[model samples]
Target: MKRLKTLASAVVAGTLALALAACGGNGATTETTDEGSSTAEAATGSTYKIGVLQLTEHAALDASNEGFVAALDDAGIDYEIDQQNAQNDQSACQTIASKLVNDGDDLILTIGTPAAQAVASATSDIPIIGTAITDFAESGLVADNEAPGGNVTGSSDLTPVADQIDLLQQLVPDAKTVGLLYCTAESNSEVQIAMAEEALDEAGIAHERYTVSSSNEIQQVVESMVGKVDAVYAPTDNTIAAGMATVSMVANENDLPVIVGCDTMVEDGGLASYSINYYDLGYKAGEMAVEILTEGADPAEMPIEYLAAEDCQLIANQATADEVGIDISGLEDAEIV
Candidate 1:
């Protein structure tokens, strides 16, 4: 474990923060009437000190942060945001979460489950809007999905695991056994894995788990399942998503069909998937933050938001298809990546 940063050194740590300021410039406007006194126009809106805690640097997580910022800007909320990335380090997440809480930010937006959990543990008084988290209840971030009894509530990137697995089966019909790949440390991935196990059981398909604790083990774990499982089903997991190049290289070399959970992963070199628009999910979370900051809405009463089935799209990678010898022509409405 890495050493954690103390709050006494917050300024030094703040300097280490990305310090991304997302707001319009020059809100000050001067207006003069018939009198000699000149009055300045009111500022566009309330300026807020916002803190963003992202788990890691990946396409999905990056999109979520961008979408959240876009929503805040569209709502006319002037905000100075401190962006901190854990870089998949647990100690870094804790250290940054503590600094953000100590910074006296008006609101905190966490992009991934680990980041949300760390910030939620740091302070409950500061309203937290989390995006890219799968199950709030399972993660202990909220009491219920409909009525979050606590301050933590936001959007859930809970992709349809069953439907995604079904896509894998459709792409590889003769595959007898499938391997579920993910990081065991992520609670969100655990929830999806359980659902996937149920889906596989219902379909009477044999399935096995290929779990890894960190990105360092992704290559070895994926390589272990080469011949044992005919197909691989990986969720929108952070660790696995970040190391997709390794996973694809190993799986593709063995002529294994790897089905991913998000469209961004397909672009990263997976076979096919039911894509979740993480940007829209983060935008939804940002709208919730707007309500809390400007509209005075309570996250405790806000229900967790999700993308409907109609919102999810089917996607496949033509390059991976040629490499793994799979046919995506049978999949309807699947956008080629």
Candidate 2:
């Protein structure tokens, strides 16, 4: 009986030793599999998310947004876009900025100055790209116009103020005084106003400023400037652009002609406008954003670029010009859309 028990114990020990050796070999194989899985994951890069914040819904702003998206599509990158419209509300703009920051976006594209300011205030880490902004210096996004030394770099939609003044003079040769209409709250409008004032001085033309805080004040402002100035110049102010119809109605009724900073304004019934295409500016901004994402370019390093095209179209409302008894002779050479 002792000899049979000894043989069974020997067999059990051998089986235990073989099982331990098998587990040791499997453990090494498992570690190698894990390392291979990690390598594969590192090779397949993760997708990125982009947030776009626009101040208001207007033709020009909408076109900018469209151009931005189109550029992104042209670059075949895996990206998601979260778009928010502030509806011309500053407070809403702040809220949208906060929400986008919290949502973990890789980059944020702000359409207008107000939206850019809100996004810049919201996050310092996330890259901020601005478009359709007139003056980065005036918007407080940068220290100077030439070098925007910060995390924010973008495209400027600034119309040449001196050229605009000259265009107005060409259209209205006999005009002695011009009235500048804009929004006081907007830094962009303020910048344009300053430039316009300087240009008017250089042209030897007398000019006055008519500033409004909101759309509600436009009628009163226009009425006040009617008999005071010969012609009115409206910059690309958001408030004025949104309430252009009212300004046009009041100006047309008062037999006044208005020269605007954008072509869309002319389409909305203004007498004429000379400005860059907003969509092209936005598309350029999108190209910059992609560079920041894929090429690993620093936003600060990318200087704020202006649209290359200085081409401005002279869109005239023939009916309105005729009604006001204003003669536009060289309009045939101008690109009338």
Top candidate on TM-score is: 1
Q: For candidate 2, lDDT tens digit of each residue in 1-337?
A: 0011121222122211110000000000000000111222245564667888888877888888888877776776666788888877777777888989999888999988888988898988899999988767656786654566777988888776556677778778888999999887777777677777776888899998898887889999999997899999998888888888898889988889888888788778788766678888889999998888877888777777776433445566665676566776675555454
Write one digit per residue (lDDT tens) for candidate 1, span 99-179: 899999889999887788889999989999999987777777888777999889999887877778778778888989999
TM per prediction: 0.87, 0.84
Give the clash count for each candidate: 0, 0
Task: Give residue 20's lDDT in candidate 1 (0 to 100).
Answer: 17
| Residue 119 CA displacement from its true place in model 1, Å | 0.6
- Once fitted onto the true fold, the runs of candidate 1 whose alpha carbons sit more than 4 angstroms away are 1-45
The candidate maximizing lDDT is 1
lDDT score at residue 99, model 1, on the 0-100 scale: 88
Alpha-carbon lDDT of model 2: 0.74
Error of 2 at 290 (Å): 0.6
lDDT of 1: 0.79
